[model samples]
Target: MRRFIDSEADFIFVLAANVASIQAEQDAIGFDAPDAKYPHKNAEGLCSFAVLVQEKFSDNPILMKMARIVQAADFKDQLDDHPAARGLQLISGGFPIVTSNDHETAERAGFLYDALYASIKDNVGL
Candidate 1:
């Protein structure tokens, strides 16, 4: 089923929540000095995406809520414990404007987002 957020405030909250979730993972796993680079890169990418979404659809609550959900998942730490988790994290992280309730949900959500993104890009001549 397609879940929708309906408001920009909700989207911001989702984004914050997902970011917080990621921070939680960082806290739990304790990355080494060398590993720190990738995490920082990931975070920067997320921030950039969020900025783009905010700029492109300032009034779309669905997009905002999706962002908040991504921020809330805490995928980093979860992945540290399970190999499968890493794939899910990458997928979800790639599309922060989508919401997933749990691991399975995350996978499905990622698939949906991937298809949607692909379709959009294809249709846009990108």
Candidate 2:
């Protein structure tokens, strides 16, 4: 998972320096390398991606909420104390079961994040 995070940071750094640098990639999507050769699940990639999103959208509550889930899921074993994090971890477990193809899984995950963001974006005072 850590390895995935490192690689994602590298990717984000490059993307930030390139196409996504001038304007915020507000439409940025998250992804998990489902079949990574790594020993454990690649939750770290999503975690890293969340970090990028947090940096880009500092005022976005929806993305921030999603980031909490990503952060929690990545560190769930040792640092997850929030109920939302725990629930996200459990829900994410099913993502792998939904599809074996990484691209499809990523697309689905993106949609899930979009829906999550949409669901929370309109609440006045949650």
Candidate 3:
């Protein structure tokens, strides 16, 4: 994934597993969704990382719909939040099995996401 980024990129952002270990950098941003102890503003407490990003760039209805599905699928307690969460479960649960690596899996999943967005746009008139 880092290889896919532009060489001239100004900054990088990542969802850190441990935000405390991240060194201060003017060109990078790190976020964490800790489930346990925290100073404040944890992602798991309010919403999934997907929701946080979607809310920021929510001008597109299709992406917003996908984000809702992601939020439901990601949270154990909110698995029923969206009707399509179960299907997302099946797709994501087995996605890594056939793919060769993290980058490959994510790149292949892009097609599925494209189809989903198109389907939503066509069927839901979004």
Indicate which candidate wins on lDDT: 3
Compute each candidate's TM-score over C-alphas: 0.29, 0.54, 0.64
Q: What TM-score, to 2 decimals, does candidate 1 have?
A: 0.29
Highest TM-score against the true fold, candidate: 3
lDDT of 1 by residue, 41-98 (tens): 2544443334445656667555554444343334354335433335546665665455
Which of 1 and 3 is ahead in TM-score?
3
Ranking by lDDT: 3, 2, 1
List model 2 lDDT by residue over 11-105, tens digit each: 22123234333224543333333332221234443456465655676686766776666676766563454566666667767888988765566
Model 1 spans with C-alpha error above 4 angstroms: 1-25, 28-49, 52-101
lDDT of 3 by residue, 1-126 (tens): 122224444423234554444424342334333431231245444444454445465676766787777677766777888998888777878888998875677678768777777888898886
Distance (Å) between predicted and true CA of 92, model 3? Answer: 0.5
**Total clashing pairs for each candidate:** 15, 0, 0
Candidate 2 — which residues are off by over 4 angstroms? 1-46, 124-126
Better of 1 and 2 by lDDT: 2
